[model samples]
Target: MTRYRPPQPQSSPYISKPGYKALNEELKGLWKTRREVTAALSAAAAEGDRSENAEYIYRKKQLREIDRRIRYLQKRLDVLIIVDKPPTNQQQVFFGAWVELEDEEGNSVAYRIVGPDEFNVEKNWISMDSPVARALMKKSLDDEVSVQRPAGPIHYIITGIHYTED
Candidate 1:
């Protein structure tokens, strides 16, 4: 049998205050759900045959999902470096800053640069390692930036940048 070892955590580049709080809350919620599911699974098993028990199967699935999330949160928490304060200069882009971009078509998009663990496009959050964030970093408003994407290069003009606790 091969012996398995958990990998050492790597240093996290950055994380926003709100994102960190969310992760912490999520971990707590997962643990609570884990306990609830385990109890429910035991109850389902006591009811009778395990093979045909729907409650048992459902609880088992829920437990697996909770365990997966718990493991992820544990690993991520170890690596993350939280940054509560934004950069002093407001004119340039920096971690945890909300940035506005204008594409060639003149359409504008706003995104907030955040840690990888907090990256959510639908929520307007982006990772620091992302191509768009990479291009925007250290750039001031009105600066033209080009990023290399899998499809090709994409260009953007920085329209605005802001940082706030909320």
Candidate 2:
């Protein structure tokens, strides 16, 4: 059987070059998370001896996790390439392009295609590797496309597309 270890948190990215600067910014934010966790740990430790201090142990665990993430981000930031602009062509879908879709039922949904690192489903963002994105790639506005999902093949029409920094 596979071990119970959880998957490491994914890096946030939107381009192939890798976003070093953004990763640095993310590491900086994580440092703040570490600092807050450390303070909590100290406060917990100061309450009493170590044996029965659940708060101390809990906070220490939290701090350790935070530090692990911080260290990874620090190392990862060194390898990413920052992408600050879009491609010259705007007529076709490309990475970072916001695509609005409508199903045959006429329900509309919009999503921004980003690198594997920056997929936020709730915000209507998808990884460029996603099937829908794959099917939509190189398709012009108003093009019709279909994706074969587990639920069955779903068809959509590209209603609109735009490239804007939101």
Candidate 3:
């Protein structure tokens, strides 16, 4: 029997213009790849015994993964709100704001506050729902913010906030 799992809370639906475009392109690419996978699956099925065919089994699994991603992307794209312009009040940190912060040790780091779907850690983009971003929201430059971490509370001073024209 399968375990019962509750549905997750809805994530923020906001996405940057470029992020939205990238998702749309990914959906389009998925469709094309799905078609190719289906064709390969059919070809493998034709050459094999249903019970013992590795090629057929592999192709079927590949197709299932592709279809799952396509379904998710289609649903996600329908609800995303694209934020193409910077907020009117640029001084305060908000979604899409590139914020620079200095830690207690005077080490500086920059991060862009973005929606969950668009957050990229490697690029230093943090989800708005994250503890650090939540504490930073609506906070202006020179403000001190504290975030709760597993290790303990960490403090930062907001040194700058910038918004880009997307």
User: Which of the numbered candidates is closest to the native, going by highest TM-score?
Assistant: 3
Model 3 C-alpha lDDT versus the unseen true structure: 0.92
Q: After superposing candidate 3 on the true structure, give the runs of residues whose Cα lies further than 4 Å from its correct spot.
A: none
Per-residue alpha-carbon lDDT of model 2 for 1-166, expressed as tens digits? 9779998665444454434446667788888888888888888888989779999988888888888888776666555455667878888998888999999999999988887755778978888788898999999998999999999999999988898856
Per-residue CA lDDT of candidate 1, range 98-122, in tens? 9999999999999998888789978
> Any residue pairs clashing in model 1, and if so which?
none
lDDT of 1: 0.87
TM-score of each: 0.83, 0.76, 0.95
Q: Candidate 2 at residue 21, lDDT? A: 49
Which has the higher TM-score value, candidate number 1 or candidate number 3?
3
Runs with alpha carbons beyond 4 Å of true place in candidate 2: 4-23, 39-43, 46-48
RMSD of each: 3.8, 3.6, 1.6
| Model 3 lDDT per residue over 10-85, tens place | 9989999889988899999989998998998899889958679898999899998998998999999999999988
